[model samples]
Target chain A: GAGVSQSPSNKVTEKGKDVELRCDPISGHTALYWYRQRLGQGLEFLIYFQGNSAPDKSGLPSDRFSAERTGESVSTLTIQRTQQEDSAVYLCASSFFRGVQETQYFGPGTRLLVL
Target chain B: DQQVKQNSPSLSVQEGRISILNCDYTNSMFDYFLWYKKYPAEGPTFLISISSIKDKNEDGRFTVFLNKSAKHLSLHIVPSQPGDSAVYFCAASARVFGNEKLTFGTGTRLTIIP
Candidate 1:
């Protein structure tokens, strides 16, 4: 892809329902990240994938939020038994390096509304 | 705790004037800082960045200044234009083992008046 891409730009789900959000990171980028942003709040780090594995899952709010990646490419974020608090924009980013000096390229983001 | 903070939630500036937005962080290990601009329903776009070694980095109309002593940073937009109206976020990262995660501020909404 030319840049990071996210599917289901806008989603509306009923409470207690499960929802899946997808992200396709930039090609050749070795690092992928997921973040959540609530209205008027900052982007909160969720998880990170280096290649096919995630070394930092400390940011996952709970066990209900789990993410998986396929060999440095596409990633999926799944939320089970969604609550109203899950309503927010989920953003994905990728970078050439998994180090601090690298600049990240972001995807358009998926806006999820859990009613 | 909110390590990075953007005190001002919103800012208004007249076209052609200079607009300044501020950010502060408490962590001393943060060696790099970045500013991202975001439009409605869109992801943030990198605007400018400054490394720990340099005090300032400029890219055309956008400039980022870092004050390590005060743990403070700022973004300046010269000759502000309507197109510059967007939410700006400040992010920081440290050069440590498995600490590549970026911590971001709440973001400041900049409104440019024509």
Candidate 2:
């Protein structure tokens, strides 16, 4: 089975431009997540989508960051007016469902560099 | 405040030796803990996990020990291999409304010298 996957392995953009990153979760996975990792830092939670329920956007750092997941499949994270601070690796993950012990499968992240 | 903390930024061990990595948490509500391994230019891969109900869980040469009272956990890899060299991340989560959002600690870069 194919694991979770993301597009545009590397993206370089102007600080004021907007960028959209895409993620394709594994088949049958109902739980998808977006995270950010800065240099020498840990993974920061961004947003999560669980099935058809309302997505959890509490982890989103600012109003400029937003995500949308259609049903239980693909998800897109859009950053408006990107800043240099937003440069980092954007990782995507998916699991069967949000359970007490569910394991998440990750993708090869998309590295975004804001100039 | 960081809910999960990996005090050590890096660790180096000789191949065939035991490697132990530690993690601490400030939130007692975290009922599940997990460890993940990541290589350069790649996303993290889930290694092992332990539930609050158990003190220890082992798989192959990997063992995760949790001390609920002290709010600490550790991952031990026996007979470490060069292939095991990577950044290890400790993550925790509190199940709220079936949520699986995780709080991760700054990763520990492990270098296995052969």
Q: What are the models' TM-scores? A: 0.97, 0.97
lDDT of 2 by residue, B1-114 (tens): 999999999999999999999999999889989999999999999999999999999999999999999999999999899999999999998886357888999999999999
What digit string (tens of lDDT, one per residue) describes model 1 on residues B47-109?
Answer: 888999999999999899999999999999999999999999999988774756789999999
Question: Which runs in model 2 stand beyond 4 Å of their true positions?
Answer: none
Please state every model's RMSD to the true fold in angstroms.
1.1, 1.1
- DockQ for each model: 0.82, 0.88
Across all candidates, what is each one's fraction of true contacts kept?
A: 0.79, 0.86
Could you give me the TM-score of model 1 versus the true structure? 0.97
Per-residue CA lDDT of candidate 2, range A76-110, in tens? 99999999999999999998873556988899999
Give the Cα error of residue B33 in candidate 1, in Å.
0.5
For model 2 the TM-score comes to: 0.97
